[model samples]
Target: MRLRKPKKEWRHRKQRRVRITAMIRKELDWIVHDKISMFILFFLPIFLIISVGNVEFNIDSRAQDTVVYVIDLDSSEYSLDYIETIRGENFTFTVYDNHENPDLVTMENAEALIPTTELGAYLIIPSNFSETLLENQTAKIDLYIDGINTIEMLVIKYQFISANLLYQVEYQVFNSEVLYIPEYRPEIDRSILENAVPNMIPTILYAVSNMVACQAIVADDPLKRMLLSPTRKGEVIQAKTFAYIFFGALLSLVCMCVLTFGFGIYFISPLDTFLIFWMTTIFGVTFGLFFSSLASSRLQGAQLFLFSFIFQQMLVNNLRIEPIVNYMPIEVIRQNITDIVYRGIPFLSLGNQIALIAGMNLVALGAAWLSLSLKKEVA
Candidate 1:
């Protein structure tokens, strides 16, 4: 039995170019000739594999634990018991002089301590709290949380609320009374937990856009590349995008791993997370290509990439549907992408974000093809 010679037909050629993951991996393997490692090879050498301390989820790492200053005006057995139980993950209880008399809490005092000391959360165990809790009357507690610190502090706040409720439940239980645990989790429709997947497909579209490929396909020095004609402009563009998809995926994977294991954020489904990350990455690549295509010089591409970094860091801040949309030149960027008005999980409805991202990709790809076509012809 013998194999036939290559057909070299158009159909065969189309079938042959069906970019495979294994091939992409192999191409990346060749990127760092000797080192052939995954993320380190694609982006930079793994400089700090050994972090000074534990890795963090969000960019700014929190302290080992958040300290809760309990001005317990009551200091009752029940309150004291509750305080002891708070030592686990989110809350570390530090008793101030006045935890027993929460009624005496001044408005100014509450404002100063809760926000200034970087506290995770603050709570008042009212004088009426114990009696109302025991007399089968509904009790209310006031908590002040720091809103500036996004997910990490938010997680601690949720935990504190849960722990507080648990203390109430135990209060009723010991007093031979019954109280229903209030079950309100804001429906979590698209809260931070679900957001672990992705707010929008920024990373996915970023990979597809393939900006890293720009570096790989450039003719080294522009003057030298003008002397060659063996490669088509289209082929060069394709190869560069391929390289970006490879690199972007690597950076994103590291980010997800750090968020998951290093931080306690749970992913309901890895597949969903992967999709969201890859899509957003493709978005980044698309923006990169758009920059590369338009710039007269490669240095311009680097400058534009920096500009994009600034814009993307603030994407969700400025670009979102909200109750009150107001932003100054810098106020626009104070928030972040996740904070943007992505009402709920994206793509659940399957049109707007996907379309928006795809539209962006079309603009990028079109520009890339057009400009590269002209440059190739000129060469």
Candidate 2:
């Protein structure tokens, strides 16, 4: 009888210990074992290196790829060759022949076209361009560029000067005692509010979508409660995902409408813009869910989002980070989306980006499923 009692007592104590250990584990999970902390510990340093810290993360790295117009007065072969040489990879050039399109050369027409065209710069080849280069010993090309973005203006300026210099070298104009000087008279676009609206749209979308992505799952107490019902955990997660997608689409639409109508932001293709925004929202939602699955609380999810955003901002276009940075969801979104909206590129052309987004969603969904399964086991 004594042996039996002692064995029973020992079994009870062992059971109690097991329960205590499990409880401790749960509490620890709620307190510290979270996605945010994991990233902070393991990946924070990498992100910091890429971002150069907060100081450089939010800097506007957005550059506008625009179109430049040209008016050719000299029909000489030299003038044509110079024009062809000045056409850059960063921008497209459209030559408007004044003789063929006389109505398009008026001051009134130019001023009207300023608002309508996405013209970054304009060039006028003087009538005596070839004559000046060969005989008069002076090549002065007139250029008027949009100076809204100083950096872009500088790029335009350098491209023109470099092209002219190359032309001089190729034609031996400089050696012929001719000064190949290019005159650039820049016109700063004073429509700051109008010009700034397009630049701001992507950042605004990213910020809003990031918040939505960071909290779509973690803050839902109702999702946790749903587990107590007869519903499977996968079903509950599916519902939450559907909600995020729907709400994300709705929110993105609202933002686009406000910008297009209220703020006068010009989107060349509304359908393309809408589709990109919707897809971006979907991407953001998945991003949040993936982290939230690994996170114990809403704050942790937010931290994850912040780390992601900073890494994206700092690492994008930085050759030091290269290939890996190119694969980031935010970078992909910014590149493809801005190309469509700002550069007027075709949406269908982004085959790689489209595939990448789909792949990311699959990965996120898998992560979310695994996380929910683990949570169920713990409960």
RMSD of each: 11.0, 16.3
Model 2: how far residue 206 lies from native, Å: 3.2
Q: Clashes in each model (backbone N, CA, C under 3 Å)? A: 34, 0
What does the lDDT read for residue 172 in candidate 1?
45
State the lDDT of candidate 2 residue by residue for 1-379, as single tens digits. Answer: 3544345442465654544444334433432444653343224323432333232223323323455556778878888777667654433345554455677664455555654446667677888998987774777777887766677677667767677777777666665465645664554332343444334445545555555556645765565654564445555456556655665566567766655565456777878888787787677667677777767787787898888766666776454386787787667777677668756787778988888888988888788878868874311
Against the correct fold, how does model 2 do in TM-score?
0.48
Candidates in order have lDDT scores of: 0.50, 0.62
Which ranges of candidate 1 are over 4 A from the true structure?
1-30, 33-76, 85-90, 94-163, 173-194, 204-219, 243-283, 296-299, 309-317, 321-363, 373-379
Q: In candidate 1, where is summed lDDT lowest over 10 consecutive residues?
A: 327-336
Best by TM-score: 1
Candidate with top lDDT is 2
